[model samples]
Target chain A: MLSEAEIETLTGVAGLMIPASEAHGVPGADDSAIMSEIIVSAERTEDAVRNALAAFAEVGDSSFQQSHPDEAAVLQTIVASCYYRDARVLVSLGRKPQPPFPEGHEMEEGDFSLLDPVRARGEIWRKVD
Target chain B: MKTDPIDVLIVGAGASGAAVAWSLADTKMRIVCMDQGGTPDPTQFPANFMDWEERRNGPDHISPNIRKAPSDYPINDDGSPIKVVNYNGVGGGTVLFAGHFPRLHPSDFKVKTLDGVADDWPIDYQTLEPFFAINDRMMGVSGLPGDTAYPADRNNQMPPVPLGKSGEALAKGFNKLGWHWWPSDVAIATQPYDGRAQCINLGACLWGCAQGAKGSTDVTYWPHAKRAGVELWEHCRVSQILVGDDGMAEGVLYFDKDGVEHKAEAHVVIMAANGVGTPRLLLTSTSKQFPDGLANSSGLVGRNLMFHPYSFTEGVFDYPVDGARGPLKSIWSHEFYETDLDRDFVRGYMFEAARGRPPVNAALAGYEWGTLPWGEGHHDAFRKLNDRIMAFCAICEDLPELHNRVTLDPDQTDANGIPVPKVDYTLSENSKKMLEHSAARATDILNAAGATEVHAGYPIVYAGWHLLGTAKMGLDPETSVVNDWGRSHDVKNLFIVDGSVFVTSGGLNPTSTIQANALYVADQMKRRLANLFD
Candidate 1:
C-alpha cells in the first residue's frame, strides 16, 4: 500500500528509530525489509498512508523525523513490531526465528540447586490465626 | 441443535459444561450439550505455527472481535477498559487459558463475613473441598504436594514444572522478602495421564494446544464425556430457553449452522455459559411465566460483573531469562492474598510470574509501557528489554458492585440474530488502590531480584480473563439468582454451573473453582434426582 517515494520516507524514518549498527551487525529498518513487513500490517488505505508520509518526507529529510512525535511514534511502533518478525534480526538477538509452538524451544534447566537456599530456611508461610 | 429427548440438556460445552457431563458419565443419563463454537481446529491454531505474525496480530488474537470467526458471537465491550477475553469453541475459554490453576483460599468465600464487603457465598471452601480434589484428579494437576501456603492436601498429581530462569529469579525475590512463593498448580500435565500425552512445553497454551498437552476441555473432558455417551453439538446457538406452562424448563430452542431452528426437549436445563454469556442467554429467554427473563426473579441476571483487574510490570535483567520455553505461569505468590486493615482496600491481590510471549509481543509490550523509548536508540533499548526481561502481573480482587454489569445491547445482534451483550464496567476505587499498592510491591520485588529497570502499566485492555459474579449463588430467592447447588431460585429445573455463580472474584484464577462448582452441583443433582424440583 506504499508508493516508492513513501517507502523511501518510511525507510528514512525507520533508520531514525533503529539506525543500522555496523559494530553490532544489526541492519537498519530500511535495509532490513522491516518497512515492507510493516506494509503487510498497515490498516490504513494506501492513499492516506502515502499522504501522511509525504508531509514527513518533504520536511527536509530528518526535519519531521525530529519534529513530528506522533507520526514518529506511529511509524516506530509498526516498524519495530514487524522488525522482530525477521529471522535474521531474531538470530542476531540470540533468539530462534521459529514460532513458539509445535516444535517448542528447548531451554536448559535452571540451577534447581538455587532453590535449596530458600528451602533451607524452612517454610515461610504465615500461620492462619 | 435438534436432538433426541434428553434427560439433561446443557447449554455450553465449556470448562464447566464438560466437567458436569464427565462427572455424570456413570449415571447413564441421556445428556446432550449445545455450543455455539465448534471444536478448536488445532491445525489452524498457533499450533500449526505458521502465519505467527498475522495470527497473533489479527485472526488468532485473544479477543473475539479481532478473531471474528463464524463461531464467535460478537460482544460490544466498548464501555469497559478490560475487553472480554473468550473463545467460542467446545473447550470454551480454557482453550485459550494459560492453565494457571490456583484455587480460591478459604477466605475468598467469606469476603462479606471477614471484610464486610460483598455478600458471603452460601457455600464455603470446606463445602467445595472434595469437589476441588475431584477436579484436580480429573484435570491432572501438577505442583508440590504440600504447599504450606495452602490447606495441606495431596491433590497435586505430579511434581511442579521446573522453574526456569525467570522463576528462579522471582523465587529469590519472594524468599528475600520472606513471602509465600510456590510453583503454581496448573491443569497442563507434565507427565501422561488418563491417555493424554505429557506437556512438550509448547509456548502458546492460550492459542490452542497442538500436542494435546495443555488441558483444554476438548482434549481433556469432552473426549471422555463423549465416550460416556454425551453428545456435543457444535455451531448450535441456543437463542432461547422454552418454559412450560407449569413454570418449569421444558427445553431449549436454538439455531443451526444453516440458520435452521431446532429444539431439544429435556427435563432439566443447565446453563454452563460463562459469567457474561449465561446471563445474556437468560435475559433473552423471556416467557409468559418469566416475562422479565427466565429464572431472573431476583432481578440479578446480568448484574455484578466482576473481571479480575490486572497490572503488568516487567523487569530488565543483564542476563537472559528465556521464559518462552515452558508454560507461561509456572510460579506465583499468595503474599497479598488476605485482607489487611493497614491497606485502604478491603481485599488483596496476587503476584504471578508472567512469562513467554513471542518477540513481537514483547516488543509491543515494551514500547507500549514506555520502557523501550523510540528514536535512534530504540534498537539498543529493545535489545536490553527483549528476552532478558521477567514480568510480574498483579491480579487484583474485584468487589461486586451493583452498578457494574452486563446488559443486552439494543443496537447490536449476532449472526443468529440474538441481541449481543454490552458490558458496563469501571474499576472500583478499592481495586485501584489495591493495584497501586500491588504494583509498587511488584517493582520492589523485581528490584530486589537484581533488575536494572522495572516498568509498570495500568488498565491494559487485554486483562479481562477472569469472568465472574453475574448470576451468583446465594440462600435467598429475593437476593440471588441461583441457590446453594447452582439451581435457579425461581425455576426448579433450571441451573447455572459456571463462573457466573461466583459470589466474589478472588485474587487468584477461577477455572479450577469453576470446575469444582460444576462437579459439586452435578453430584447434588444426582443425589436429588428423586425430588429434584422439591
Candidate 2:
C-alpha cells in the first residue's frame, strides 16, 4: 500500500514510537519483519495510513514528534498492533509468544491466611426481616 | 408465514432465557427459544490468536453498536453518559462477561424499608435463596463458603479461582485497612465439572473463553435445555409480540436470518431480552387494543432504568504483578457495600479488584490518557505500567429514576429495520458522591499496596455491563410492569424474566441473581400451571 519513500518515513516514525532496546532484547517497531507485517495490515486501513503519512511529510519529523494529532493515532494503532505481537516484543514484555488458550499460563494459589483478619471481623452486611 | 402454536415461547436465548428454558424443560411442555445470534464458535474466540487484543478491540468488542455484527441491533446511546454494552448471541452478555458472580445481599431486597429510597422488591432474598443454590450447581460456580457478606447458606460446586499475585497484593491492602475482601465467586469451573475443562488461566474470559471453562449459558444451560427437548431457533430477531383479540399474548412476529418474516405462535410468551431490549420490544409492539405498547398498561415499561455506575482506580507497581495471566476478576471488597449514615451517599459500592491490561491495550490506554508520549520516553513509560498495574472498579448501586429510561428512537433502526432503543440517562447526585468516595478509598488501598503511582477515572463510560430495572416487578399493577412472579400485569399470558424485572440495582454483578430470578419465575409458573392466566 505504500511506496519505498513512504515506507521509509513510516519506519522512522515507528522507530520513534518504540525504539529498539538492547537491555530489553526487543526490536523497535521499525524492524524489517515487524514493519513488513505492519505494511501488510495497513492495507486494511489504507486511507488512514496514507493520510497519516501525508501529515507526517507535511509536519516534518521534529514537528510531528512535537504534535501528536488524530493522524498520529492511526500510525500509533498500526505500529502498536504489529509491534506488540512480535515474538521478541512479547518476550521482552515477559509474556509467552503463544496465544492464551490451549497452553494457558499457571497461576499461584492465594494465601488463605490473608482472610483471617477479614473473617475475624465477622459479617458486615445488614440484616433485614 | 405462521407456525403451529407451542406451549411456551421465549424471545431471547441469553442467561435468563437459558435458565428459564432449562428449568421448565422437565414439565414436558413444548418450549421454543428464538435468539437473533447463533451459538458462538469457540475456534474463532480472540484467545485463540496471537492478535487477540486487536480482535477484542474490533469484532469482539463488548458494545453491540461498535461490534456491529449481523445479529447486533444498534442502540442510540449518544445522550447517555454510559453506553450500553451487550452480546446478542445465545450466551448473551455472559459470552463477554468476566464471570465475577456475586449474589445480592439480603438488604438489597428491602432497600425502601432499610434506606427509604427505592421501592422494596415484592419477594426477598429468602424467597430466591433455593433458586440461587440450584443455579449455582447448574452453572458450576467456584467459590469458598462463609463470605460474611451474605447468609450462611451460600456454597459453590468447586473451589475458588486462584487469587494471583495481583489479588494477593490487593488483599494485603484490604487487610491493612481491616476491610472486607473475599475471593469472588465466579461462574468459571475451577475443577473438571459437568464435562467442562478446568480453567487454565487464559486471562481472556471477557473476550470469550476458548478453554470452555467459563460457564457461559451456551456451554452450561443451553446444552441441558436442548437435551431436555427444548428447541432453540437461532438467527431469528423478534420484532413484536402478537396480541390476540382477548388482549392476551398469542405469539411473536420475528425475522429470520434471510430477512424472511414469520409468525411463531405460542400459548404463553416470555421476554428474556435484557433491560434495554425488553422495553424496546414492548414499546414497539403497539396495537389497537393497547395503543401505547404491549404489556405497558402501567406506563412503566421503559422507566426506572438502572445501571451500576462504575469507576476504576489503577495502581502502577514496580514489581511484577503478572496482572494479565489469570481470570479478569479475582478478589472483591464489600467494605462500603452497605449504606451508612456517616457517608454522604445513602447506598454504597463494591470494590472489585481486576487484573491488568494486555500489551496492546496498555499501549492504547497510555496514548489515550497522554501518560506515555510517543518519542524518547515512551519505552520507559510503557515499562513502568505494562503487566505491573492492578485496577479496582467501584461498582456502585444506582437508584431507580423516572427520567433515565429506554425509549424507542424515532430515527434510528437496526439492520432488521426495527426501531432501535434510545437511552436517556444521567448520573444522579447520590451516584456522583459514591464515585467520588470510591475513588478516594480505592486510591488509599492502592497506595497501601506499595504502588508507585495511582490514577482514578470516575464513571467509566465503557463499563455499562450491568443493565437493570427498566421493567420492575412490584405488587401494584399501576406502578410496575411485571408481578413478583415475572408475569406481565396487563398481558396475562406474557412474562418478563430478565434483568428488567429487578426492582433495584444492587452493588454486585446481577447475572447470578438474574438466573436465580428466572428459576424462581419458572418455579412459580409450574406451581400455577393449572390457572396460569389467573
TM-score of chain A of each: 0.64, 0.80
Q: What is the lDDT of residue B401 in candidate 2?
A: 97
Q: Which sections of candidate 1 miss by over 4 Å?
A: A1-8, A31-36, A43-74, A108-129, B1-3, B50-54, B369-376
* Candidate No. with top lDDT: 2
Worst 10 residues of 1 chain B by lDDT: B49-58
Q: Show how many residue pairs clash in every candidate, following the order shown.
A: 0, 0
Docking class of 2: medium
Per residue, candidate 1 scores C-alpha lDDT tens digits across B1-534 of 334579899999999999998987778888989999899877777656534644655688889887898888888999998999898879999999988898888878887778888988998888899999998888888887656557775468876776888888888887788777778898888889777777777777778777777788998899899999898988899999999999999999999889999877999999998998998999999987899888889998899999998988888889878645677787888778888898888789888887645676677666566666555666777777767878889899999988889899999999989999999999999988988998899998999888888888776588788789999899999889999999999999999999989999989899999999999999999999999999
All DockQ scores: 0.42, 0.69
**lDDT tens digits, residues B1-534, model 2?**
225559899989989999999999999999999999999998999999998887776788888888999999999999899999999989999988999899999999999999999999999999999999999999999988999887889889999999899999999998998889999999999999998899999989998999999999999999999999999999999999999899999999999999999888899999999999999999999999999998888899899999988989988899888667888888888889999999989989898889888888778767766777776677788987788878889999999999999999999898888999999999999999999999999999999999988889989998888889999999999999999999999999999999999999998899999999999999999999999998
- lDDT assessment of candidate 1: 0.81
Judged by whole-model lDDT over C-alpha atoms, candidate 2 comes out at: 0.90
Model 2 chain B is weakest, by summed lDDT over 10 consecutive residues, at: B1-10
Per-model TM values vs. the true structure: 0.93, 0.97
- What DockQ was computed for model 2? 0.69
